[model samples]
Target chain A: MNAALPILALFTLLALALGLYARRGHDMGLEGWAVGGRGFGPILVFLLLAGEIYTTFTFLGASGFSYGSGAPAYYIIAYGALAYVLGYFLLPAVWRVGQANKLVSQPDFFVHQYDSPALGVLVAIVDILALIPYLVLQLTGLGIIVSLASYGAIDKAVAIWIGAVIVTLYIVASGVRGSAWTAVVKDIMILAIVVFLGLYLPYHLYGGIGAMFAKINTAKPGFLVFPASGQSIWWFATTVLLTSLGFFMWPHSLGACFTARSANVFRKNAIALPIYQLILLFVYFVGFAAVLSVPGLKGAATNLALFKIVIAQFPPWFVGLVGAVGILTALVPGSLIAMTAATLTARNLYGLARPDAKDDEIVNVAKAFVPVIMLIAVYFTLSGSSTIVSLLLVGYSFVTQLFPALVASFFPQIGVTKQGAFAGIAAGVLMSAWLTFTGQSVGKLMPFLPQAIKDFNVGIIALALNVIIMVAVSAVTARKALQPARS
Target chain B: MRPVYWIALIPFVGILAGPVLHNHVHPFILGMPFPLGWVSVWLVITAVLMAVLYALDPANAGE
Candidate 1:
């Protein structure tokens, strides 16, 4: 057996135990499985939403950004805090609409709110197209975590298979409640391990946190501060604004909002969630500590900066505990996306298929798709790799297009024409794709455009165009459509 | 549009002004770069503002 085998097995078993524990003595029905009976109060709702937000991206991506890209990493911190402010108003309305309409999944909201099954279908297609790749990304993160944590004792492919199997079974068995219960365990583990490493790694290596950052700032000059040159402040500000708008727009997040017993749960969570930002700061400390010591991490290799730092500084057993957190970060989100995707598949796509399905039938069909979604994600994890596929991980940009439609739903008087919303979404997706795949953000396309526009994230640029098209088209349509009907 | 709604803009503005205010490497505040320190301060402030908003909102008073 490998040196990591014992602790790895122990943590993995603990994960499975927690999954089963959440299901004990509860009657599992469609609503119970899908949104945890729409009865959860503040604490469970908070944990569920937190689990969904802090995925492999938070664990690996933030530290990677700090190590590789310099100061732009602060965007992660800025966006989440801003999002809570927005969600304070946005989610209560979303929850109110969801509760009134009896919406269980993402597409159900659009269908009931707009009274347009076609719009629901379009949103469903866009959402799932965006979501599958996100699921695949988390699976990939799990594979990397397992492979690296075991010191190459476990193969990446095998590790991903094990992760997929566990996540699939647990989600299928326990549903959103499983994900919530597991999150409670995952958050505790994450808090302990991160704070320990954050304080110890810096102080143990350097004299203290202050000394470490001071030395880096002195050596690299602008390294500790935001880049004053090519990575302009406009880029950072727009990126944060874009991410904040798109933050809770994800299908899983919207569905989770429906789980809250009252809008007060969301309101309370918005107040409390920012406290978790302090934990993210601890991870940032670890990332900043890695810079001078673990230098020369090129490209995707940068994601390993924090983990490699932990390995170099800590013992194997403690490293094993961190590895467990890595797997939890990946698996918790993987299970979430899988469950949400399955919810969409049964609730949305199954409607397109049968046209006459029953509620129980839809629920059963969704439960069945749990394994299929996991299989598809795992297949992409082990076998799929292409530029287009990787670009799909930029789901936030595309999904930000949904903001106009959603805001319209929250207030009926907003008056966005369905055709306009459709056109806007189509335009946003295409613009985002063209800008991203063409490397426009890197100064490859549209040379005549200003550097500032080019420097802004493609998502924000696409969102601007989406809003313009939506508003202009709606104004023209509403003037013509409203006059004849008002009489 | 209650006055409470404007409170949300405090964190939003503080972060958007990141490029303008405290855009420097020197003089770390609590062991962080000025921009980062600026962000960290506003993050906590955002929550406090949210708490105050919660208190002021007529919706919560009914409970």
Candidate 2:
């Protein structure tokens, strides 16, 4: 082991101790394990929310994208802020409904509102399916950071497995409280390191942001402009819109919502989250700065961009701290994702499979599944061929199908029939899969639509088709229910 | 009557306008380098707008 390994080990041990300590008070029950017994105040909620939002992707992927694409990479920062603003209105409704119903998962809310177990199962399955890829993305990021920090001494697969095991233990032991409490420390360290480094790195490297951009512009004008020549305007708009829509739909965010002590906590989180995003703006700039500072480093393992920069510029000791921060970033979300997946499987699949299961038994089952899920995630992380963003987008596209059922449930009058919801979900899913695998636009596939409308994002177009089908089927089936109310 | 709608618009507009207008008009605050610049201004505006909207939307008045 290198000299830094001891420092990294010390940091990891401290985090684990804190996580275990936080688990002391809560009972080993489903509610306690999954939702922290529904008792998180604003501070904890804020930290948890912030932690969930800033993953390894934000650290590595944003910089890599910025490094690769240039200014348009700022959209990552832009969309995060937009997500919170959207949540300010959208989440309160969800918070109130969840509060009233004691909703545990996103599917629980959907099924509770619509009175449809089938829809709940569909949401759960889709959530787990979508979440696996995301979890793998986080794992892959963790592996990259570890591999970089260890200077190839630690194998990527071994690094991912080691990180996964540590996180899985904390989550299984402490659950959401474990994740939340650690998140408090994780967020502070991340914010401090990122802000300090974001400012220091640019001036140290290229004098200033303006100077950096100037060099980048001369070298690669496409990076500075919107919808650069290779990327079309439609693709940009659709990607941004889809990314914004799918941001809050992640099951982990919903899991965080249920842990909020009150609706006001959720609201405060929404209001304060953009401040967090402002910090993320610096993280995004680190990406652009990386391009100018570290040229010809492209195609050299995009996931290691941030670690590479830190190692090149900062000292070994400081690199250790940055490594700790990067590891913590992965740890917080990694634990939560494992917890969310476990909870999803336990509550949705196990519970659905065996309705008579006890609460304690369910909690135990969830705890047991944490490591299993992490192993699966580790397997995929090692096995997958694509980058983190590609995996995440595929997952996002899958989860977006749930939007119609979720939105429709808010209006009691709409009364989307279970059959209709499933039909829409099925059609949307098939369309998305076809579009994803075939690489041919629906227009090209059908040979009927204009070229402009042909090359659509599978997710956006599929989501649209889902909404249309759901509305049509609901209207036709519930036509009598849709009639004007008798006076 | 919900200011929340208007409040949401600040960031909404920023995300839409910041990139479009990024090439022109670099706004500064008190001669300091506002790294966020337009995004930060938009966030502050959005926060104020949201706060105002929350105050006006009686539903948000802690019923």
Give the alpha carbon lDDT tens digit for every residue of A1-487 in model 2: 5666776777788778878888896685888888888888889878877775688888887778767765445556666667776677677778778777777788787677666677778888888888898888888888787777767777888878888878888888899888888888888889899998888887889887667666666677455555422233334445667777778788988778888777777666766776667787677657767775666765536656677788889877788788888888888888888899899888888888899998888888888999999988988888876766667778778877877776676665776766677778878877877777676554556567654444444467798889889888887778543332111
Number of the top candidate by TM-score?
Answer: 1
Query: A201-286, model 1: which lDDT tens digit per residue?
Result: 78987888888888888778777766654566767888888888988988998889999998888888888887787678778888
Look at candidate 2 and tell me the lDDT of residue A324.
Answer: 80
- Estimate the Cα RMSD of every predicted model relative to the unseen true structure: 2.7, 3.5
Point out where model 2 deviates above 4 Å.
Answer: A228-233, A440-458, A479-487, B1-4, B21-37
**Candidate 2: TM-score?**
0.91
Best by lDDT: 1
How far residue A188's Cα lies from its native spot in candidate 2, in Å, is 0.8
TM-scores of chain A across candidates? 0.94, 0.93
What lDDT is reached at residue A327 by model 2? 83
lDDT of 2 by residue, B26-53 (tens): 3433221232356556666666666666
Q: Give all candidates' CA lDDT scores.
A: 0.79, 0.73
The residue pairs in collision within model 1 are none
**TM-score of chain B taken alone, candidate 1:** 0.82
